[model samples]
Target: MAPCVTEWVTSCTNLILSATALHSSYRLFKDHRAPSVGLFLLGLSAALCIVHPSGSYLTSIQKEAEWAGEVLAPALVSFDFLWLSEDHNTAHILLCGSCLLLGLCDWLSADALTVMTRCLGLSSLSCCLTVCLFAGNALGALSGVALSLPLLVAPKVGAITFAPLISPAAAEGLVKWLLKGSMAVGCWASTRALSMFLLDVTDRCNMGI
Candidate 1:
């Protein structure tokens, strides 16, 4: 797809904070089990999004990434603060609750391979079908093979809060690395979800959902 500078730059900036956050979270992963839990959490979160009334927490996430961007993913645990559309009470609680679970799962799935391996079929299916909801899955799943590079290369400048990728001065020291990772991973998926939601289809393929 031809890239839009605004969207591209925004996506890149989001990458920086996410990479930093993942790097920090890795430290907390003791042994292999932590990663296992992380994957489970991610899987669970995805499942919840699929089953919930308003397609899970995708709405809250959509606004967060569009506005909050990077911090939205790294601070996955704090997804409670994500944006809202048309005032949804069930979605709000479910969104926060679901994000909390997904955070724990991601902490367990340390590597993308784990999720990729399990979701391989879905990933391929996502590519074949242009399900409006899974729109991002096409390139997203393919990119899963090398997710880290983008994480490192995406811009870190003009970055706002929790954007650890930005050269934060002592003033911005408040935002830690873990927060960046949480926002990155969470927001990334959230954006993808929003894409699917906006398109309004739940078929397996689009962004490799």
Candidate 2:
């Protein structure tokens, strides 16, 4: 498939996945009583779905809109992870802080900042992943990896496929789209899996099952 078409298809898929996840999460978690945490989850899901990268394909101001999904969405997820954590240790704060800083640096177009953004973005993912694993939410850790790996990988893939080799732009674009789709999946899957796991534990406790 052509690069443009592939990008379109990937974007569409992410939109559907994110929208579905948001709807499903609302239905599953509403009225669960943990209002603060629930709102954070729903809010993050909604933000990812609404500010999705697909908008860039349709909007005239593509570059500006792209940041919402590329940077803001994952940053919000990192914040949500920290907020949901039972303990706010220094490491967790630093990790989440790195994720937030990456988002801030994302807006700058400096060549020097590009490397910083990539390193910090990857580190942010690790931060979230560690936080989730420490909290015993394996699904959340998986989400962090799926959604953020592309940030670092896309550039290298682009470099490898540059010029006559294979159109670096296409390879990079494809990786980015996959990243967006993974964000959708991560947002939905982590929340859904965690909710179901908690419910199961609660049920077993009550029923002695």
Candidate No. with top TM-score: 2
Q: Model 1: per-residue lDDT, tens digit, 1-209?
A: 12354334444444564343344335323422222233333333332322224644775654323322221222232221122122245335434533444355435554552343234323322322333223434433322222222223223422556345444442232232333334445434433433433343334346565
User: CA shift at 30, candidate 1, in angstroms?
Assistant: 1.7
lDDT of each: 0.34, 0.55
> Compared to the true structure, candidate 2 yields what TM-score?
0.60
Candidate with best lDDT: 2
| Superposed Cα deviation of residue 195, candidate 1 (Å) | 35
Off by over 4 Å in 1: 1-3, 31-209
Per-residue lDDT value at 45 in model 2: 41
